[model samples]
Target: MIKKFLFSTLIALCSISAVNAQSKVKETNKLEDPDNLASQYFSQVMGVAVDATSNLKLYKFIYEWIGTPYRFGGNTQKGIDCSAFTKAIYDKVFNTTILRNSRDIFSMVNPLPKDELKEGDLVFFKIKSRSITHIGIYLGDNRFAHASSSRGVVISNLNEPYYSRYFYKGGRILDSVKDELIEE
Candidate 1:
């Protein structure tokens, strides 16, 4: 009986030690994760280049400005149109210029199937006439971000009847190397 008690105690102590070691390892891992530090750095860089990041936030801000008013050839928080919105966003973010309109933007970016689309990618629509008519920023989960004339900055699902019918091509910008992108 004494031997059994000693063995049981030994096992208990070993299990306790193992649990403590695992807890320490988890804490160490939390500190070592690069994603944790990179997010802080990304916030600083994004602020400095607020006008030049990527597709999503630029369009996100544009969507916020929707219903401010639409003016011909205007580009500002006060007023903007389809082409103007697209041009202004790309110009501000990444400091690159996009093709003037829906058709041009559709043609400029690399073509990728809708199934392969991800966040910050461009979704083009073929409305009215063919040749691409509207553009939105893909938000993943089959939803996209865009500045609707009526709803302003909003997320729309691709499954929606209107969007599903007009959906055509998705544009993925492969310009930046993976190492070049600040993933945080």
Candidate 2:
């Protein structure tokens, strides 16, 4: 009985110390500049390496659309679908217009191998069926922003087990949206 009590007390103390240390680390690392804070937060969320030139507009759309509720065939902040969300992002950030459906966009662009994916490239997934059923914008460093059927708009790692398994291909819009491709 005494041994059990002592062990429980030790575990509780260790857990509290760990929580405190994590809070301290978070406090120390908090960014002051809004741009820097956004960049840092997105880098961590997307599992990407952010630099000075990281696209702020992309982050802008992601932050704006985050937590939107999913709705089939919808295209507004009140509710949105995956393809609609992708199209809106491209239209807003890149000034590029894309097809409103996942498969159409997949068919429209130059298909690329996963290894060749870059920021602004479209990442496609075949979640339920064999055809491309979902799409997201790649944000480099193996991260992509997508509107999930359940979770709405979110940034997720391509290497995540579920996404990795469903990932079909990456698509680049150089030819399709040549005039709108933002030259960096």
Candidate 3:
């Protein structure tokens, strides 16, 4: 009788240990899923639904540079200007190179109306100047990512009073230019 009781206790302990191990494996798999983690992180950052972060590459690039400080002509994480940030995104995410200044970059695109703007499009601003002095990458839902002189790298809405006041135009890269870049 004593031997049977001891054997029964050992079996129960083993069963409990196996169950706990399985539970941990399930939790680890959930945490390791890159798509799920990216969706959750960007959704919270952009203040949008999880499904809205469908372009994981764009969002991931933006996430990595989100809080970088603004510096005129700067191009790295230590400091980056609007045009530099825009160029970086295109270079890394789209695998294309864009002009380094706002006005010149404007020439590479076909001007788009705000209502027709799409993800990965360029949004230009006159700011305090008459020319295109600032630029940002459109991120859908009226939000854009840019390196602001006052706020460093951030996402802002087109409807914001400050942005609307100086909004210049939206643009998409010309198909010819895209093709040329790809060929090179």
Candidate 4:
């Protein structure tokens, strides 16, 4: 009984430590300046050395994909939605898996005020309800890239009357997330 109790206590302690660490990371790392420790990773099997430049390539790739059609279950050059576009960028840039949609994505990151918005941060909107229904990548000059329903892919501004009213949350992923692409 004592051994079981000790094991349970250890597990509980570990969980608390993890939660605390996440909170601290969230507070310290701004979406604007995230750590980029992964840039030095080497793939000996492929005889390739990936570096910070990969992020730029990824960004340009996503930008080029602008105007692709929005499809329900899509992840191709042909079509994609807001969440899928964000996921595709992260997956390609950082080689990570994010939750499938906007609401789930919101919970994984920390929200920031609009003035702190940074490039690459996920911006969310509560279009239909309190739950976030849409997401986009924060591109500077107050513009964001999103897969609009009627417009396919598009760049939107926070100053836009429609988006300004629907704006709900702006989140910045912490550096310690061990995921998501962070441009160095």
Q: What TM-score, computed on C-alpha atoms, does each candidate reach?
A: 0.58, 0.74, 0.80, 0.64
Per-residue alpha-carbon lDDT of candidate 1 for residues 1-184, written as tens digits (9 for 90 to 100): 9999999999999999999999999988865765544433433433221222334445445445545565555566666565676666566665665667777677667888889986667888877665777787775668775655665444578889998998898987556533234452
Any idea how many clashes model 1 has?
4
The TM-score of candidate 1 is 0.58
List the global CA lDDT of all models. 0.65, 0.86, 0.92, 0.73
Backbone collisions counted per model? 4, 0, 0, 0
List the candidate numbers ranked by TM-score, top first.
Answer: 3, 2, 4, 1
Report the C-alpha lDDT of model 4 over 1-184, residue by residue, as the tens digit: 9999999999999999999999889766633343233323221211233344444554455557867998876767688888998887777765666788898988778898788887677889988687888998776557777888778777778889899989987887666564334442
List all candidate RMSDs to the true structure.
8.2, 11.0, 6.3, 18.3
Clash list (residue pairs), candidate 4: none
Query: At residue 101, what lDDT does model 3 achieve?
Result: 99
Error of 1 at 31 (Å): 13
- The Cα error of candidate 2 at residue 19, in Å, is 39
Best lDDT among the predictions, by candidate number: 3
Candidate 2 structure quality by residue, lDDT tens digits, 19-75? 999998877666556778888886776567766688888877887898998899899
TM-score, predicted candidate 2 vs. hidden true structure:
0.74
Superior by lDDT: candidate 2 or candidate 4: 2
Question: How much does candidate 3 score in TM-score?
Answer: 0.80
Query: Could you tell me which residue pairs clash in candidate 3?
Result: none
